[model samples]
Target chain A: MMDFGSFLAMGGYAAYVWPAYGAALVILLAIWIDGSRRRRAVDQALHRLEQQRNSER
Target chain B: MHRFANPGRFLRLANRIQPWLKALTVLGFIIGLYLALWGSPPDYQQGETVRIMYVHVPAAWMALFAYLLVGLASASSLIWRHPLADVAAEAMSPVGAAFTLIALITGSLWGKPMWGTYWVWDARLTSFLLLFFLYLGHMALLGAFDDRARGQRSAAVLAIVGLVNLPVIKFSVDWWNTLHQPASIVRMGGISIDSSMQWPLFAMAITFHLFMLAAVIERMRTLLLEARLRNQRLAAFERVGTQARASE
Candidate 1:
């Protein structure tokens, strides 16, 4: 049987520890994704605006 | 709010400030990480794992701080009709939700070794979880309406209502018996921790602040561009009508 102490001592509770690490990873990924999507939206909006400006001229 | 409502003006200022914000965030994170990993002594209680406080605590703080920003922005928009206040609030909502999730996850991670449980419904934890819900609610409310203005206005109201939860979350640890630890870095009685812990904590705080600034500026720039596009389309429609009348 795997001892409880041994289990926890494995990377110092890394079994439980992995969740937090995963959480942190997700948070960073969310920030990057949100920023990038917003950037893309801005680019699209600008492209449309550029087309409008030229057509009007 | 009115002062920065002009997109051209806002973009110029943001362009100048983005570089500095980037530099500050990188420098602060480096110093904070160095101090947290190497400079500080381990807790008599938590050992080296205590170092996680440097990131975990500030993120928890930012989760709350970001909402307060949303609440304030919503209030400004509702009151003064700041051109893009709702836009700002909407932009920051996802970022805030992400931070709240990080805080909850990290808190749970720290809790398992110390408290021996992966989950708890304690006051601090419960309220923080609700904080994440508030962010979701705001996001949902914003998209609920086919009319963007109507959607934005409704979300702004929801954000304002959610502001009440911030204080409840902050004081929950003190007001109730909690598995969570109390604040050591920014106590009303002054910081009770040692200098070693304090330095890294301060560094992390600065880094988080700079990170928020960079994210906000980038998001705001995107909002400005979107609004600009909208205005152009409307103007073009008006011009088309005038030419059609002239040709007739």
Candidate 2:
């Protein structure tokens, strides 16, 4: 098994390395989550509109 | 391109491709991160810090690539008036900005260890910052007008004009004496980096590209749906208004 301690250490550059990866992960996650939420909201609105139209018919 | 110009057709195609793209992105990230973190040997000179290049370089590349797509889409929208091109360009702006932001942040993180400073007024770095602003400018211009067409047109113009910054960013290291290193992978002669490092970098770059594609397509679908919803509501309101008038 790889030594978890040294991996975290990243040969003494952990402070720089970990934060770089972390920031990227967080930003990507935010974008993905925001997009998915927006899509769901729009989809729901469309479905409601379709249902209303059907009922009116 | 013409066939896909229809938003419905485009959305259908996008939906089909999205799941595959998502899978590829996930697989690439897994392999790339594994290789970058442990599989590859540390650089002889920079040691493990060299690993930062995998993330930093790919983000930088995607930033430029996304802007290029925006500029090209803008060109098509302006010239041919392709129906989907404007939406494509608008959808790409925030994604491009996010990549640019990532690039700048990661570049700073890398710089702190290698260059002894988080930032310097280097040409490459400065031009990249300008590219980020250009993206924001494009996005803001899009919302500036009451008329959506006018907003899109103005943003398209900005995107085309911003093309000048791409070459400037690419050539800045060569043109000026700067802390940022000159091109290594892409150059006149050949790639300078070792193969051990190259594989992980390529994997991460591909992953970022796939991720960007999936994100843009998702955003476009949402935007198209929102536009449709707006139109539906307007039509419903108009119908109700006409009925009330007839009843009166």
Candidate 3:
């Protein structure tokens, strides 16, 4: 079995391999976070509008 | 499918499926990453750089898959005037665009190490770049007008027209000489990739699709809420206008 250090080395292609995976991770997480954040913001705005309408009535 | 075209019903279904979908995504990534990083063998020629394919291939596939979806949804929106379809097409544009960006960046990264260049203006790469622009154009059209329906209708037209690029992107590698390799998994003969590599690739592909679906559902819900908010504000404005007229 390869040692821990060698595994991290990725057979000398670590620079290319790690960054590719890292880029995918970042992009995927960004979409997930951005989607949920927009959803939450819109939901909150809708809620506030409804509450204001009720109070006025 | 048409039955669920009602946004309320679709939102309820979305809410129910979300937790399960997220859990599966997390689980799939755990397994997929393990196989991709540890279990899979390095390529004989590409060496450890082949690991990039685990992420790059799935992302490229999703980029195309998402566009295909946007195209189909746009067609439905244009033909049937389904509001849900408009929301769907609009919601998926950014997701598809993000995946396309990932594919481009990672492909470039892989290209640098293997082909000794970050980019080339070959048919496959060029067509894929056009796919990214189509997504941007679709999103831009969606918000171009004050009238939401008009904006959606216009965007739907653009998206349906852009569907022509899908086949060109798919066939470009075959039809032209390019640095990008031709199809390995979906050729007429069968998948050329080894079974050992297929496990992580397929797992990551499935996980990416689930992630895309989850993101789309969330965006769809937001669009629905925004529509409701618009209607509510309009009604409130009308009420105030009526009161002002009565007092005058």
Candidate 4:
């Protein structure tokens, strides 16, 4: 098993390393969330249009 | 390829692949993160700081790869007037820009420890900065015009012209003496990096590529739907106008 303390410490470069990884994770998550929200909005709009067409018919 | 140019067909294909892509992306990230953090051994020189390469290298590669895609798509849009090409190019900009931003930030983070400074105006770094600017410029030009087609055409031209920078960025370290190291993994000989480090890097690269594809497809779908909604609203307004005229 790896020592958790040394792993976290990252050989004294933890301050530099973790934040780089953290920033990447944050950006990736943000992109995913934003894309999902946009997709949902588009789906709702399309559904409303379909309902309107059905009512007209 | 041509048949898929139809938006309906394209959306159908995008929808089909998107779920699979998402699953693969999530799986890749899980495996990649585990390997990157623990499976790989530390570098003799950089020590634990070598872990940053797992993220930085992949982001840098994607930053260039995405620009290449955008440039090719823009060329198709301008030359053949491919229906979805402009949209593809436009959707790629922000994602590519984000990758560039990540690469730059992470590079700076790595640099501070290794080089004793956050940044330097070296050949490789400066060319990469220009790439980030190109993405922003493409996006800004797209929104600058009132007419959508005109805006797309203008941006497509900009993207194509910016293609010159791609090769420059790739070769900058080789062509000029700079703080940035020259190509290691992609040179004439075999990869200088060890097998243990290589696996995690490959995994991360795959993850980032899949994530980019998913994001682009999702954004394209949204844009297509918005276009359809605009047409529907316009049609409804026309119907109302006709009815009002008839009643009068």
lDDT tens digits by residue: candidate 3, B161-233: 9999999999898899999888887677888789989998999999898889888988999899888888888
**lDDT (C-alpha) at residue A50 in model 3:** 85
Give TM per candidate: 0.86, 0.97, 0.96, 0.97
DockQ of predicted model 4: 0.81
Regions of candidate 2 where Cα sits further than 4 Å from its true position: none
lDDT of 2: 0.92
Worst 10 residues of 1 chain B by lDDT: B46-55
lDDT (10s digit) by residue, model 2, range B1-248: 57888999998998899899999889989998988888888899888889888999999999999999999999999999998898899889999999999999999999999999999988999999999999999999999999999999999999999999999999899899999998888677888788999999999998999999999999999999989999999999998999999999
Candidate 3 residues lying further than 4 Å off, grouped into runs, are: none
Please tell me the TM-score of chain B in candidate 3 relative to the true structure's chain B: 0.96
lDDT of 4 by residue, B111-224 (tens): 999999989999999999999999999999999998989999999999999999999998898899999988887567778778999999999999999999999998888888
Provide DockQ values for all models, in the order shown: 0.37, 0.86, 0.84, 0.81
Q: Deviation in angstroms for B36 in model 4?
A: 0.7
Rate residue B96 of model 1 by lDDT.
85
Each prediction's whole-model lDDT (CA): 0.80, 0.92, 0.91, 0.92
**Which residue pairs in candidate 3 have backbone atoms (N, alpha carbon, C) closer than 3 angstroms, thus clashing?**
none
Total backbone collisions, model 3: 0
lDDT of 2 at B60: 95
Tens digits of per-residue lDDT, candidate 1, B1-248, equal: 56778768888998898888888877887787778656777688886567667778888888999999999999999998887678789878887888888888787778877889867999988999999999999999888998988988899999999899988998898899998877767677887888878898888878877887788788888877777777877887898899999999
